[model samples]
Target: MITKEKILERVGGEEYLIRHLVPTFSSKVRKKNYKSIFSEKDDKPSMSIYKERGVWKFKSFNTGHQGDVFRMWADYYGLDCRTQFKELLELIDQEMCLGLNAERKSIVTPKSIFPNSPTVKDPAASFPSQTLRIEYMSDYESFISRLYLKYWLQYGIDQSVLEKFDVKQVSFLSYTANSGRCLSFKYFEKHQVVSAYHISGRVKVYIPEIAFSFSSDPYFKGQKKSFSYKNQNKDDVFGLVQLPEGNLDYILFTAGEKDCMSAYAHGFSNVISLQSEHQMPSEDLLRVLRSKTSVLLCCYDNDEAGKNASKKLRDSFGIVSVQLPEDVKDIAEYFQRYTPNDFQLLLGYGVQQVQSITVNPIDTHRVRRLSNTKRSKVKSYLSNKFNFRLNVVTQEREMSTKRNPGLWEKINVNELRDNLDRHGFECNLDLINCILKSFFVERFNPIEAYFLTFEGNEFDDGKDYIRRLAHYVHLKDPTPFNTRYWYIHLKKWMIRAIRTVFEPEGINKHALILCSPKENIGKSYFCEFLCPLSLIRYYNSNPVISNEKDAQKSLIRNFIINLDELHQLRSNAHVIKTWLSQRYVNIRLPYQEDEITASRIASFLGSTNDVEFLRSDLGHSRWISFEVESIEYIDDEAKYILEKSWEQAYHLYKLNPGSGELSKEELLELSQRSDQFTTKSTEAELMVQYLTPSTKELGEFMTATDILRYLQEIVGITIRLNTKLVGTSLREAGFDRVMHSDIKRYGYFVQKGLI
Candidate 1:
């Protein structure tokens, strides 16, 4: 018996508490935040847990649940406070016995809640400890009754199967003097019986009304009731001993002992069963199965509960499931309904047949060595000798009178590379790189051609597309002369989005920035619409990207990386500019052993309220900025229209991708206008307003201090700056220094068209 204080001390405090409780609740601790592991869609941290005052405390933002560690653990196990305390005490006692050689300590008995009662030991303290014991029958012949054998035979379990598993029947007397019988299935471990499962065959005696009035009815006199022993080692599966002694090609798992016997009778020697439908195999048993068997077949009953259990097993262990015929439910019923030959045919039909490929390790290693210096030779060798080909399929197919949308399916290059590596291949990096590069090039050509087809059509015209999109989102064009100007900006964005999908390499060379100082302009929503939902990775909070390693993390697969709430990022424009211009990026996935160079496939999109977003020195080549002023609420109708339009554009692009080129004049105008609208800094803005054009005369030379004062007086803007800082700001704003010979002062001259 242990007290709460003693238990806490023995279990090594709150960290241990958290470690124990989190797994029990099917939660995971990632970067100190506890989150649900069951759902992939739930990316947010479910609870914030921390240790305080020598105890663990947690608050669940998802459920509005807050409590100390003990209460949380109790809630997870569906236990009341008192019962949970008792359980915790027992758990701590077990841990102390295992981890430390602590002497037996007296438990603190809590005072009774009842007013008159005294303190006493917890009720759980008196509970019997479960132990495994094997009981042998002294009268085996007498116990194996005719009724018991007949009962089993009715269920298609013959005497031979019963003898093979060493099952028995027993009669016993209960405390109530009622007589009963049960069929017992003995469980063996390493050829020794450690436990047994008993199926009761007891019937209640119904006395007549006159006999019930008597103190003892004649029918019930000297009757003995039956009792079954509970097995402590319940984790072990029931029929492992019956499994064949060599490598099994496939093992059929059933839901009960009878099912196991039925399967064995039907010529499935490689069969195992759980104690009941509700019990799953233990980890040790699963590991053994994995090592010995090539395939696992879940042959549970056809009922709802059994199907659910089978699915759970399939997901957890990656096993294939076998469903019975419509009329049959369990293995016993199936044996009753069909002949052995029919059962074999049904088993063959139920098995999932997967094609297997075998590779020679020496040949793979030789090919890998050849790939490093002679990539083309290796490619030719693999193509001719191994019949390797990059498989890419069309994105549409004719179905009846209408065309159905098709999916992009290609040979998995990573899996191929892994297979090569597993076969003792060296220089796998070079081999994989060459193969993937070829595959991408081969795959993307058709996609690029499909996008180009939309250029000439009226419905897919760049201007018409943008106009429809703007109207759907309720966006008003800023300039009256050409709503087409806004359309041109949007067209550039559409090209970028298309390129992100079709061009896997160098797609990160530019990023799109949607800027607005006001909220509810649908900036983020538009970003989501441009990319597929599966390929969009969101950063609700800014991630560290100041270094190469940090920058590498942002290139997650082929995703459109969304840097939402861009104002929170402490990174300056120069870092972002460098990141966006890279053709290839270094990636070190968390589980990988070495860093690998991957083609830059991720496209960055950021939304922010900051008007002057980038540094003055950073050029506009890598950024396409859009200033959205429309702040109207988008209703369901508008959302549907937007989705439909975007889908049309995507399908058109996939059908007819254009030649990957942009008009030089159009691109230059769009870049300049985009820079003016969103990318210019405060200092650049002021220079654009004040500086004279290059055709006009240059402004007068003045000291930095004097220029600052003039700007303050003219613009009604106050800025605190020293001469050095002012000079730096001016240089960044495209201003140059000129000498005033008479005054002997070197002051900055504001060149025309500097902005």
Candidate 2:
């Protein structure tokens, strides 16, 4: 019972065996280039050894000879690796004193083979594999290794079939044995040492890379087993992941992974394996698979164990067994012996045809008039078979349509009808609607769903956004402008604007206004570009606030509202402020039964040519005004910066929900800065010139009417005699109103200046 796994453990590892058996013919083994050890006339050094996925391998450019340590040993001795693999293992054990065979006591010295070389032994040979421990390790290439793929291709499992099932080509794989030995294998054309079998579950099965007829080989006589597994998981069902979505007319269950792949190679896509014939599928798995296919059939190997297991499954779960011909061992062999069409013919004879299960045959004209009882039965059947639900955020109906189930996709009415027709249920649009009404429906908040779709790189701490903003837009705030201060506030405003799309309470009460006297500076384009390309449909450039109904509808549908002409809104500053301050809009939408309140997700951005866009002094805080020197058109770099800024803002918002909100100090600073954008207030200017703050001991109190009378008479100024304007101007000049109880009115406490 001496095996290669046990001998490899005793000899440290395969790497040691390669260094000992194969000597450097031209130069030292540590050099980059070495003479070919297999050829006598290899005058040029063209062979070199390299490690791939922890397995030591060598390649010869001169002769195109390449393989792992075991393959190299076989090539050096001029032996066929497939038939004489047992001899290869025995030779290594005899050379390394591995003690695999107690009867073999003689050990050969390396100096005898290579006469000019010294017999040096590595001290750490016993634990060489431990130096690079590969536990649950694997690597994938674009295609399966050509050498390993060549073996399976014989059974008709081509590249497309393997790729469809996600069966990857393992470049190299290493695993630890139960005896604490780490064994690694690499795939090469010269001789593939191991095979990698990828199934649906978490198991990784490795077998002999090349299948050999062991009847003539004395070492492997009477032995058919060739499997060594590593990193096996709880899931036993193989090929389940490769099943197509929705219920199939029929699905064939095979005995092993190879057989399952072989069935798929041939047009049988709906096929799976339970790892072995004896291992019955779990009850829950069987129930799920039964719902996914109309008919389930089993095709095991042509042997006693396979037949007994097939019968047991048929008796217990009522699975139909497709017995193979006595000459063929399994489906893989059957496909090799006969054509795919032959196998298809055999399947029809072995498995019974699936019969329709409908209680009544419907006439084409009466499809719409199906009885309530029959319709209810169809609905119940669909509900029990598949999970159907509606995504309120995406506004689409979807059903669990995956082969293994649990994967949902948008429902296509026509596709559903076709699938139903195949199942013996004559369905129409009306009937399908009736059946869908019974499906579970649920709603989700659109705002949360919209923001959750962002998946990309986030900018660093908003500084990148502030830098880009400073480079693009310049604020006309007073002389000696603090670029850092204004840009930081603008960045905060941008983040808050983004949050406005997710928050329904309308936390952002301001609109970003870009002003420039020159025309066509890309101002409008920048405003439009503020909305991400993914949500470009939700960006409204031609916004009309005059129509209250249309405005409310826009608030619900659009995420970004571009106020095109900012100066035109100056006439309706009061109304604009009222509209901007609304948290939710209550309006009757088209087709809506009655008035319904809708949460607003729109954040406003505007562009105007007029420098003096702010006409009202009271609503200046609601507009973040900036005079742009220039705005560049949308490009790749600009798009990246804008996208990353939103991503970063979202990241910060999720981490700190209130990160976008301004503090009390910031609000006060913003209010002070907003004054520079406001138009010159003539009334406030005249009031400040005519009035002064009262001293603590000496002051006179006057009403707004009295102040207006003094400005028209005493100051000799022609002005409108409006008491409310006079009172507002006085307050704007830093005057506090005093409640005159004696006079039953409110007046300001001030003393007249030089006037």
Candidate 3:
């Protein structure tokens, strides 16, 4: 059972044997020869190693003696290759720790073979512990023939990158729980393969003879692919050897060798990889790296294991952790799905400080209201009493906190002054401003620097928030008409509201409109409650839109801008629509000298006590209108719902921000369902008296002009027929738009009905 092939496979291939047999052999050297070990003393170094037919062979020109690795191994023991081949296999299996012996008898290695070998003390020690003895082959034919390069190519990794990282194609791999000739990737250190990372299942091998002679095609067979690591020498890091010397800005440590190479292929350098996410370099090695680089960033697989490992590295060594999207497993797969620029956008989110502190809000309130606090005590009071925490935390153009972990806005000096003044603490404006600047520069805890958004609550999962939102709609609009789409719109709006808090630039274009026939329906009160209590200061129920600039300022400053009395804005419909569509506002605050482009963070919520608040014209899709029977007072429930929902939304947004986006199809469906809320036009009602939608038995295809002319002449309608109104009326009267296929023109399918 212990054959030469099995021994060779266990010790890595022929290439591995040669590298290990001759310790002085350097694969990097070209046309270089080493002194022959077979001869007693050769005057000249005449033995050279070269590849022949996918195998590594050695030859000595001095004595005209040369053969494969087996011949060389036998010659080292002063035995003939042909006669002593069996003994050579046994010696290899024992010395290399192949564990191939069936009888469990320990055959001693020949003293002559390892006469000066360092591993002679331990006969089974051919490689360094925990490192791999990876086989290397220069035969591009085997690499191409096995079709192993395609796996890396699909992840945007080319042959050059694979070769750069010393990745080799393995046609045959034998390990525990796996033995096959399937195509796999072997990661080697110089000439010896240490680790194996399989990217795909078994690939069909291209048999040249079978294909060229037209005898048969490539064979298709499937095998259980595996990922494994083996060790031969101390060199474990994949890209560490290739790293440039000293003083780098940043170096990325990825989950695997492929992820490292993938980053390099995407135009990022100074990157290295671990054996796996779980394996980290020694403390000494990490310290040396820290001195050489400004920052060490680790981007591991998006799984729980990778996340935990990355966090450990961050906590232990101050290495920054870069988070990957939930869908991607690793950086290689990330590049496969997204562009390099998309990855660059995430780099800013990773450069965070190692430490973060949390301050108690109750203590902060107590500190702010202290009567004895003077200029000298400002720092101590803010730091100790107010419980202000600080850190250099950046998350996609905003500060991210550990407690509330999303984007947050930094509070300006004016806002801080206002807060202190309101809390009954009197301090000079200049001193207050100076202390704030110093605190900011010092990178104090997050709360002192940025405005606090809603923190995630463990008890709430957002289901109640969703339930309340659904119930809120049902209570406002008791009618069964379009209830399904209303709920759909409400869910989407809530998602967008959450998104706006995290991603300020993400505009929530649609506004929820609550209409009622009577004034006592509590529409405005519910709209006011839509904003969370924490953000109630930024909620304006009576937004003055008379001055357009003021309206823009309101949008820029507020979290929720309620456009109350929707009927009062009938003449301002075009302006309101324009405001709804805007993603940014170009305006200057009183504190700023020049106008600055600011993102629109405000979400609109409207209320009206008029039944026909909506106009006859189109462009009402942005107004999510509903007729309310009544909105009963549920103050406590509403506050709890708003607060908890925001927290839940924040959690969900962090997971996937793109989930808030509305597709074109979804918008169109919502738009169609919104038709019931639009006030009916007089012309539409008049046309409905005589016209009905097409029936198979009787109908006529007519253009808007033709329909208007018929209504004016045949029906003797004296009212001035507006062209656009006629088209709108036709659709309103259940006249379906149809194409006159023969004439190649669009017309309405209509039939004459009794008045």
Give the candidate number with the greatest TM-score.
2
Candidate closest to the true structure, highest lDDT: 2
* Tens-digit lDDT string for candidate 3 (1-755): 57877766665567656754675665556757887776656888999888788777889887676888888877665556677666667766554534455233344444353345432222332222211122334465542333445556767778777646545554333221101111233332111112233211011111111122221223322222222323221123567645776688678888766788889999877788755676656533564467677678889988877887887776555678888899888898899899989998777566554234223455456445653447545554454433232332211112333355454555455665676677676777888755553322233323211223443245445365655665765434445546666666676787786566444346788898888777766788888877766557678887777887788887766778899988887787778888887765545455422234345667889988776666664266788777777665666767777666656666556667666667888778767756666776656766877777885347888788887787777546556767898887776556778778778888877786664
lDDT of 2 by residue, 78-165 (tens): 5466787776676665444343443322322222123343332321122112122112213333123444466678789886776565
Which candidate model has the greater lDDT, 1 or 3? Answer: 3
Residue 754, model 2: Cα distance from true site in angstroms: 2.8
What are the models' TM-scores? 0.34, 0.45, 0.42
The models' CA-based lDDT, in order, is 0.51, 0.63, 0.60
Backbone clash tally (model 1) = 18
lDDT of 1 at 6: 61
Question: Of the pair 1 and 2, which is ahead by TM-score?
Answer: 2
Better of 1 and 3 by TM-score: 3
- Candidate 1, 435: how far from true, in Å? 18
